[model samples]
Target: MRSISEIGEHHLIRRIRERAGDPPSWVTIGIGDDAAVVEPARGELDVITTDCQIEDVHFSRAWMSMREIGAKALAVNISDLAAMAAAPRAATLSLALPPALLVDDFDAMIDGFLDLSRLAKVPLVGGNISRSPGPIVIDVTLIGSARRRRILTRSGGAAGHLLFVTGSLGAAAARIERFEDTNTQGSYERSEGSYERPVFLLNLAREVAANRLASACMDLSDGLADGVSQMATASGTGAVVLSSKVPVDPTATLEHALRGGEDYELLFAVPPRRRRGFEKIAGRSTTVTCVGEMTKAPDLLLDEGPLGGGFAHF
Candidate 1:
């Protein structure tokens, strides 16, 4: 068996296809496209989330520019808001920078953060910056507002619900491996291009919120399997994913989809009756796959099999 770095991106995604499954009711879209959309609330629901990016753990200076780092940090957090089908209004950023980094580079990083903020139409209201003895770190907290009935959450899923994901999986993993290979050949541009630019699925979120299509929702920052498991745990339900139907990146392989993190896509669930509406909307867009279904059991299964392998954080 080859490691994810050796299998390349597309091949890794192919592996994920073998274990993917469908989502529950209200999930309008799932993996194999640019974004995921879900409806979990009826009227209005507020959304809140926080995420952190560490220099050596989440990223490295050797492979990422300060600008890219800043943008990615902000994008990941906003992606969380999008998962809940909420409109992000403001964010607070906290930065811990090492003294070794030049002041100009720091300024560029701030510019990058601001760039993403403007693009998302979310203001950077306040934050704290300080020196760090180790590598750079960034923590961002985002606040979003949704109608009380429109807010989506990870805990609403139940038995007989369908499963869904937004966007193709494994692109980021493929990009990482590609970067390593290209860097060895002194071709940095191609490697950089493989790195995913943060995508704001605000439009999809708005649609889901307005429609009340998702019973539960969460972002795939870790991995598809892990994200679904989190949702299952939150909702006190079990799930079964079909290994063959998972939507993966055309260029990525199974390994990438199973273990790669940082995809920053959305994963959601909905009841069975609402699956048609989801399919109808998804048909006009990119492929939104039915990867699995929810169960009353508390276990999370992949490809209708036991769950053991996937990404994990220590």
Candidate 2:
């Protein structure tokens, strides 16, 4: 297969646009344009989020396939949209590629990403591609929309709201730890199913938003501790997370579940009054679990002590 250098940028861009297929009606303009133009639904507010994945930092080429890497890049951004209970509309992907990267590998990666995009009904609208000096980088910017009254945010929660999370936490972190410890991906391929496609929980988020069930919400990209801290800080409240209540992944430790990050599960707060409604909606999903509650005080505590650290970029 030809390397990116052999195909050149313009031709590669054409191939990408061709693979993206036709844009949906809401997209006034898609790829091959100076910028994307999209029409939002009446009375709906837009929600936008961006996420980046870099080789070595986010994934190792030695273990992760390009397809898995691409799916993960889009999945992370989608998780952000899900946190706001928004329906995805369009996405832009910016890629920084080494000249030596094979065209076939890039195609495979795009296929992986597009597969998820189609599943989510998010069109590939626009983006830029450039040659990188070193490792590959995939960055995605996603745009979504939700009715103003139905949008969820970290600042809306109050001290008396019950804390809940969708799906178990720290499985991704555990997978990473296993990879690091073993230095081989072969033994854990079966377990890595979750790492490839992190749960977005958009449907559940929408239900909570539409029913006004959640007072606050965010995705757990940085683990439960960080999620709790952020939500509490934004809402001008404190949090009391119970270690015993946390639904740890089978292969992960309690610590991993608390601060390992990359879980991509929805973390939300429901007021005591709305508990019944929230529970009714969430009960449809067996993965939902209640971990703790918001507090009037300003400290974030796991049990009786302060919360610990999670994944940090720096």
Measured by TM-score, the strongest candidate is 2
Q: What's the TM-score of every candidate structure?
A: 0.78, 0.95
- Report the C-alpha lDDT of model 2 over 1-314, residue by residue, as the tens digit: 79999999898889888888988887898887889898886788888999999998987766777777888899999889889989988899999999999999889789878888888888999999999999999999998889888889999999989999987888888888878888885412434445333434887788888988999999998889989999999999999999999999888999888888887788989989988888888768646788999999998999999987667888
Residue-pair clashes per prediction, in order, are 59, 1
lDDT at 51, model 1: 91
Model 2 CA deviation exceeding 4 Å by range: 185-200
lDDT of 1 by residue, 223-289 (tens): 7778778888899998888778777887788668766766766777978888887666644554567
Q: What TM-score should be assigned to candidate 2? A: 0.95
